[model samples]
Target: MEKELETTVCEERIFESLYRKLSKSIHDFLYYKYGSNCNPNDTTQEAFLKLWKNCDTVSPAKAKSFLFTVANNMVLNHLKHEKVKLNYQKATTKTHTNVSPEFIMQEAEFLEKYNAVLANMKEEYRVAFLLSKAENKKHKEIAELLDVTVKVVEYRVHKAFTILKEQLEGFSIK
Candidate 1:
């Protein structure tokens, strides 16, 4: 007589099987979404850990979705906590000391000119330029935040640079 196979596997067995089957795929998915900044192995492990913890509620069939959801959330949380640091070097005229009147006047003048040019730029171009240069956001991130495409962001930023270059052609910090 042929014996019937088990319909329900034990939680441990199910977890192991899921891990073996989906870990690499989950890691690849997370890596693609988050780039190299996030450790895909760690995220994948954490996702499986969560699945194991909720094994009673999560079944083998549903584990893929659960793992992806957990991994995506982890990546987003990591991204949210990441800090973008910008190193700014101040431009100085050779003859002017830090506390010199000439330096202060030149800096103020440059700021005023820059502000004027930025104010006159189109809204979309200005937003993309600031997000890219000042905020240090990637084109993909900026596109998502602006609800536009990467091409649109690239186009706007290029247009902004063109306008600024034209406007500031004759203007210089002296």
Candidate 2:
């Protein structure tokens, strides 16, 4: 007798089957891509949760790619956020006990303006800009990371810089 195929993840058996089929593969993918230090197991669980949550829109046939893309993007987002946090930590940890209060205030205000400008910019441009300036990554590296061409990265970085310059005309970090 043929078992009924599942059209949605609402079926317990089908969901279990998918878990059995995909869980190890997804775990392995995250492990190899981000290393186990990233907690591939946790990311895998999150990916599965997302799959369950979006099952209505994602057919079983498309679930594999969906899971992989979501997991990869989640890792990228985590990495980007960590990078920003680390940079901010490094910047703030530097001692400036000899600096005047006015200079410190100006620096803080400039940083606020810079963050606001980045937030208002297109995501692509902001990402390229941060990778270039914050991480000191080359355009080619940014292109590889973003899966875009070098020219595209260059354009985004340039646009980001132009926006920063225009918006922060009166402000200087130092």
Candidate 3:
């Protein structure tokens, strides 16, 4: 008897290929949608794990779509858990430094203001800003990652710079 043609993602080779091709995109999607607060890296891994767990049901052709949907839902569900967002934001804002107490206090105050301003900034501006500056992505790359025109990416980044400059008047990022 001849073996049946494999259609599902049960084959390790197929699964690996899908992973190599789609993982980065999925991670980027989650990051653009939720920022560091949602921990997009973890979310992407979980989405792939779900796909692997359901490999017998998910076809190779639909695997990409499945991963994206799973990741998006995972982040949304996580965001819905209220305290999780606050916890992540707080955790990220906290800092550990070996400087003098006065400097430490100043750093904490700056961190608090920075986090607060970021939290209040428009989501589009913040996302673009972080990706461009924190992540060190060029405008064209960010445009591609964000699925927008280069001009739009430039505009959003400019708006983000304006917000940061106004909000962090005395605090310079060196």
Candidate 4:
């Protein structure tokens, strides 16, 4: 008589197989979504652990979806928490730099002039400039957020800088 093969996939086998197959993809997903703010390795590990915990209910065919879903949710939660923390810090923090009265006054005047120039710039130019400079968003990201093209974002930002430079010709920050 011919012997039969064992076709049942147990939890341990699933963990080993899935870890090798899916861990890098999951890590790359988290890294691309969250950038450097989140630890993709840690998030990937947590996702795998959760998958192993619920392995009995999950099949190898469905494991990829399950892992991705878990990882995505965890990253979203982490980003939300980080936003809250950052908002709290911004609300409560104050700069305490020591400087002479003359330097402080010069700095304030420069800032006031800069703000006036920025405020007078075209709305689109100002928005692009601020998103690029203040928010540190990439041109591609700003373009996507504003529903414009990358070339448009680059042009607006450049125009804004040129306008500001001309408007603040005599002003210098100390």
Better of 3 and 4 by lDDT: 3
Better of 1 and 2 by TM-score: 2
Candidate 3 lDDT by residue in tens digits, 1-174: 123344568888888889899999998888887898899889999999999999998877788999999999998898788677777777765466667999879979988989899899999999998998898999999998989999999999888788888889585554
lDDT rank order: 3, 2, 4, 1
| Backbone N/Cα/C clashes per model | 0, 0, 0, 0
Name the top TM-score candidate: 2
lDDT of 4 by residue, 1-174 (tens): 121123212557657878999999999988998886789999999998888778767767778999999999999999899899989888955667578889999989988989999888889999999999888999999999999999999999988888887888674322
The sequence of per-residue lDDT tens digits that candidate 2 reaches over residues 60-120 is: 7778899899888888898899899989878856555888999999899888988888899
Q: In candidate 1, what are the lDDT values of residues 1-174, reduced to their tens digit?
A: 122133222356666777889999999998898887899999999988887778767656667898899999998887766642222234343874569788789878878988999998889999999999888999999999999999999999889888877887554321
What pairs collide in candidate 3?
none
Q: How close is candidate 3 to the true structure, as a TM-score?
A: 0.45
Model 4 bad stretches (over 4 Å): 1-10, 92-174
Model 3: lDDT of residue 166: 87
Clashing residue pairs in candidate 4 are none
lDDT of each: 0.81, 0.85, 0.87, 0.85
Worst 10 residues of 3 by lDDT: 1-10
- In terms of lDDT, the poorest run of 10 residues in model 2 is 1-10
Model 1 gets an lDDT of 0.81
Clashing pairs in 2: none
Q: Return the top candidate by lDDT.
A: 3
Overall local distance difference test of candidate 3 = 0.87
